[model samples]
Target: MTRPRYGDLYFGLSDSRNEANQDRDSFLQTYVDLNGSTKRVVRGDKFLVLGPKGTGKSALAWYLQFAEPEGAHLALVRDASSLPLAEVPRLQTGQEPGPERTVVAWKFILLCNYLELLMRDQGCSINRNPEVVRVARLLRDFGFMGDASGRALLKFSTTTVTIPVPKLGTIYKRESSSALNIFNLIPYLEMWVAEAESAVRHILLIDGLDSIFLNDAKYDESLSSLVQAAYTLNQKLMENRATGSVVLLLRNDIFSRIALSLPDSQKMRDDLALELDWRVLSGKAGVGAPLMRLVNTKAGRALGVDNFEVLKYFPDSIEVGSRELGVRKIPTFQYLLNMTRHTPRDMLRLFEEIRRVEASGIFEESGDRLRQEVIHEGVLQYSTKYFVGAISNEFAGYAGGPERAAAALTALKAINKQSFDGDEFRESLASVASGIEVDHRDLLRLLFYAGAIGNSIGGYREKSYMQFYHRRDESEIYLQGNFMLHNALIHAWGLRRTLGNEPESQTGAIPLIDRGAARPRRRRRKWEERKK
Candidate 1:
C-alpha cells in the first residue's frame, strides 16, 4: 500500500470546531485544554464551564463525554435546542418552587438521564428497573422518550421555565394536599448509585445549555433552576459518594444572564464555575500564548507528528514591503493571533482554512519531509477571509439569528473604516439602509461581543482593551470608548490598523486592502467624452 502525502493527510481537518461530528477519535486526537484547568474542573463532581461562543464549550463537552478521565463513565447530552423542558413543574402550590424545588427538578431531570444510561449499560431492559422506569415514564409524560438513550435526552430540555411562573402563587393552595412522591426522583437515583458504586462512577455532561438558557425573560426562571441544581446536586453527590457528577457546559454570556437573579450567583461564579477563557494574558504578555500552544497541537496532528512547535510548519517571521518602502519582519504566530479574537476554535478554523487553501497546490510544496512545508501568504489571506465570514456566523445566533447579523456585517464592510468615534460610527451606520435595524450603540455592543471589534480606551499611552465579555456586569462600558475593528478583519473589511501612538483620525489614512477595494472607474472613450 502507498503512503499518503502531506497534502492528502490534511483532509482530516474539521472546518468548524463544533460537536456536530461526535467521532471520539476526531475529538481525542487534536483536543487541547489551554492550561489543563478546564480538564481538572470537568473531572470534579460539579461545575460549569463558561465561555463565549466558539471558545470550545461544546468541544470540551464532547471531550468529557467521549474522552472522559479514568474511573468515570461520561454520558453526553446534546441537541438541547429541541429539549422538551417546558412541562417540568415550575409551580408547587400557588407559589413557584423556591430555589430548592427548582433545584429538585434539575436533579430529577439529571437522574433520569443517569438512570437511562445505567439501564442501557446493564443490557437489562429499561422496563426491568422500576425506579428508572418510573422516572422515565414521568419524563415521557412531559413529552420525552422514556426508553431513549441518555444522549437523546438532550432534545427535551430546550425552553426554560418562565419567570414569575404563572399560577405559582395561585395553584399551590388547591394542590396543597398533594403527595410529592412522584416528584422525588433523587431517592431512586441515590439507591441506584449505591448499587453501582462498585462498578464505575457516572457523570452526566449537559451541553448546549447556551441555547436552552437564552437570555430572554422566559428562560430566567429555568436557568436559575439549573444554577441551583449544580449547587444542590454537587452537594448531594459529594455527601453520598455513590452518585457521580453533573457538569453543565455553557457560554459565559448565558451564565451571566442566569446568575443575575440567582441567589447563589456569587457562589456559582466565584466558586463552582470554571471559566473557559482564551484571553488570559500571562506575565506581561498581552497575547494568549496558550492559544498558540493549542494551535501547535492541532498543527502537529495535521502533520502526523508529536512535535507541536508551530514555527516548524510556518516561518517565524514574514517580511513585507519592498526595499524602497522599508521592508519589516513580523512574528508569524503573533500576526495570526492578532488577527483573531483569541479563541481556540477561531484558531482551529483559521488553521483548517490554511490547510484547505494549501491543498489547492497554489503554493510551492515541500518534499517527503512534512515539517518542511510552508504556509504561504496566499494561504494566510484566504484563511483570514474565511475566518471573517465564520465570525459573523459564530455570533449570528447571539445577535438573535443569522439574517440580521449577516446584514450588520454587510453594512459594516461597506462603511469601510477601521477606527471610529461614537458620533462618527453612528453617522456611518445611518448610511447603510440594509441589515438589522439596531441603533449604532447596540450594534457596536453586538460587534464588540462578537469579537468583530475591540474597545480602545485611555488612548495610546495607557491603551486598555475591552471586549464584550470583559466587565460583563458593567453595562456602562459599552458607550465609553473609541472603537477599533480587529486587525484580522483588516483585509476582509478593506481597512487598515495603525499601531502605536497614532491618533484615531490619522489611523484611517493607512492603505486599504487592494483586493477588497472598490473597482476603479473606466476612462471614457474620446467620442463618448465629447457627448459629456
Candidate 2:
C-alpha cells in the first residue's frame, strides 16, 4: 500500500479509467484460449472459481467488470432473495456483510442493463419488435401498463422509465399474494422483452458465500446460487450461445462438499467455473506465460536506465540456455526471498509483512540486498507456516513434521545425484532412506520443483541456499544437495551413518536449530511433550 514508489509496479488505484481498462482486458484479452494444441476447450454453462482464499477469484471478477469485454458495463446483485423478480441489475456480492444478497441482486441485472442503455442518450428510444408489442398489449389489457404511454411499442424515455427492465419477452408478474409467486420469474422476464426488441445481455457474477459462517444448511449457498442461476439463465435466455454469462467463484473446499452432497457433481460442469491451482506456479512449472508478462511489466520500470531499450519480460536468453533453469519468472518483488513459492498469492502473502516493515522506515536505503534482515525473515516465514501448513495436511499419508520433512528433502537430492545418473540416486534413496517413506514424497517433489537441490557430482548443491538472512555478510555453504538442502534431515542422515559406529558421534551428527542468535539442539522429550 506504500504507493510502490509510483512506478510500473503499481497495479493502479481503482478509478473510472483504470476500471475500464481492466474490464477490457478481462473480457477480450487477459486469458489465452489454450484449446488449439489439439482440440478446443469445452465451453460450459458456468465458471466455478475454485481455489483457496486469497488466490484471486474475487479479483478476477472485479477485473471482468472493469474490462466489460462484451461491451455493456457489468451489474452486480447484492442478494438473490432480496431481488423482487421485477427489478434487474448485474450482481457482484462479496463475503463481508451479506453474500447471499449478491445472487438476489443479479437476478434483476438483465432488466437494469437493458433499461439503462435504452435511456442513455435520449429520454427513451428502442427498436420495434412485434412480439414486444403483443406482450405490451396483453399487459395493458391486464391493467399492468407500467407508468408509461407507448404507441403499442414506442421509444420510452430513459428518465421517464423510472426503472431498469430488459427488452426481452412478455413479463409475467405475480405479487407476494400468490402461492406460485416464485414461479413468476419466467413471466417477469418475458414481459420485459415484450416492451422492446433490443437484446440486452447481462453477465451476472456471484461471489462470497463460504463455510466460514453459514450453518451446514446454508454452507454451500454459493453452489445453490450457481445451480439456480444456471437454470434461470438457460431457461429465460432460450439457451442462447452468444450472450449472457454467470460466473460463480468459490473455494475448492466448498465445491468438494457440494460435490459429495450432490447426486452427480459432474453433471453440472461448465466452462465458466475455474480452478486456481496455485501450486502449479511453483518455480517455472506453472504460470510460465503469465509469469513472463509480469516480468516484462516489472523489468521495464525496475531497470529504468533506458526505458526505450525495453527488454522482453525475460532478458534475451540467447546467453542462458532456456533449459539452464532459474526463477527470474517469479513476479513478487520479494520473489528472490521466497525461493519456494509457487503461486501469485503465495508470493504476495510470503512477503506482505516484510513489505510493511520495509516501507515503515526499517529499510529505506538501497544496496542492502545481500545483508537485508528481511531476506532471513522471508525465508523463515515462507518455509515455516506456508511450506508446512502442518506436515500432515501437507503431506497427507507421507511422513511430515519439520524434522522428517527436512530428511526427505535431503533424500531427494540423494535421489537426483548427478555424479551418478538421476535414476541411480533416486533408486538409492528409495532403497535406503527411511525418512523418504510415503508421506514425505510430495515434500521432496516440491523441493525439486523449487530448485533448492540439484543432482551433481558433489551430491546435491544448494546454490541459492541462505543460512539465515541475518548473516548476509557470510559466504553461503554449497555442498551435496541432501546435506545442504534440508539441514535437519542432513543431520539425521549423518547420524544414521554413525549410529552403528559411535553413539556419541551419532549425537553430534544431529544438527541444532538456531532459536535466536544461538543454535541449539532440540530436546526430543520437550518437543514430544509440547505435541501431547
- Those runs of model 2 whose alpha carbons end farther than 4 Å from true positions after fitting are 1-8, 11-46, 69-180, 190-201, 210-215, 235-238, 261-264, 270-272, 281-343, 349-361, 368-370, 377-532
Full-model lDDT, candidate 2: 0.35
TM-score of every model versus the real structure: 0.73, 0.42
Q: lDDT scores for all predictions?
A: 0.53, 0.35
lDDT of 1 by residue, 66-99 (tens): 6645324545454444454443435332224565
RMSD of each: 12.2, 17.6
